[model samples]
Target: MHEDAARAFYAAVDEGAYDQLEELLTPEFVHDRPDQTLRGREAFISFMRDERPLTETRHDIEAVYVGESELAVRGTLRDADDERLLKFVDVHEGEARISAITTYTTQVASRLTEQ
Candidate 1:
């Protein structure tokens, strides 16, 4: 169920379905990254709407790890044509809402998928 939720969240973000975000996130959800943290679902939605609006974005999920209350997915963030932009691992907590995201822009050859 968490896996499905994870996919749905990513799909919603990639497709720019901002209206659906509230249903997928806790009202007080927190998103932490290396450079910034977004606290609360409204903050996340604002970032998605104003800062990270990439309508052609897609995730090619390669691995998923599930724990009692945590879910993690490792994937390639790709363009509409499937060209890799970054390698990322998104971590979700509390009812499958994403809590953190770590992204690698520096491609380690092992992580890159040959197009």
Candidate 2:
């Protein structure tokens, strides 16, 4: 109930569970990111499933905030060896299914994780 969609999203992406991802996203889903914008669920899913640079990675969620019509999550993306790759904040908006997403990311430094 609380940040359920957001949590499901990260899980789906990390595990490459495209079926679950489709169920959680609207047909008109759009993603706006620092590097590029992906329009439509199909396009986004295609990119995630086939074209993304890093496929063997996972998101380690740090926090989630739920609002009336939006949800925001902060997390770090880690490689297969559990090395921190980057930090990201994603703001998602939708009703029953996520319709839109905006992502901000920064490369993580090895020193940050040494502690």
Give the best candidate by TM-score. Answer: 2
Off by over 4 Å in 2: 108-115
On lDDT, the leading prediction is: 2
lDDT tens digits by residue: candidate 1, 1-115: 2788788888888878877767888788788764467888989889877775355778788998987887788888887777777777777787556554444434533323332
Give lDDT tens digits, candidate 2, residues 1-115.
2498899999999999999999999999999987678999999999999887778888999999888999889999888889888899999999989999998889544532342
User: Relative to the true structure, how large is the alpha-carbon lDDT of every model?
Assistant: 0.72, 0.87
| lDDT at position 108, candidate 1 | 39
Model 2, global lDDT: 0.87
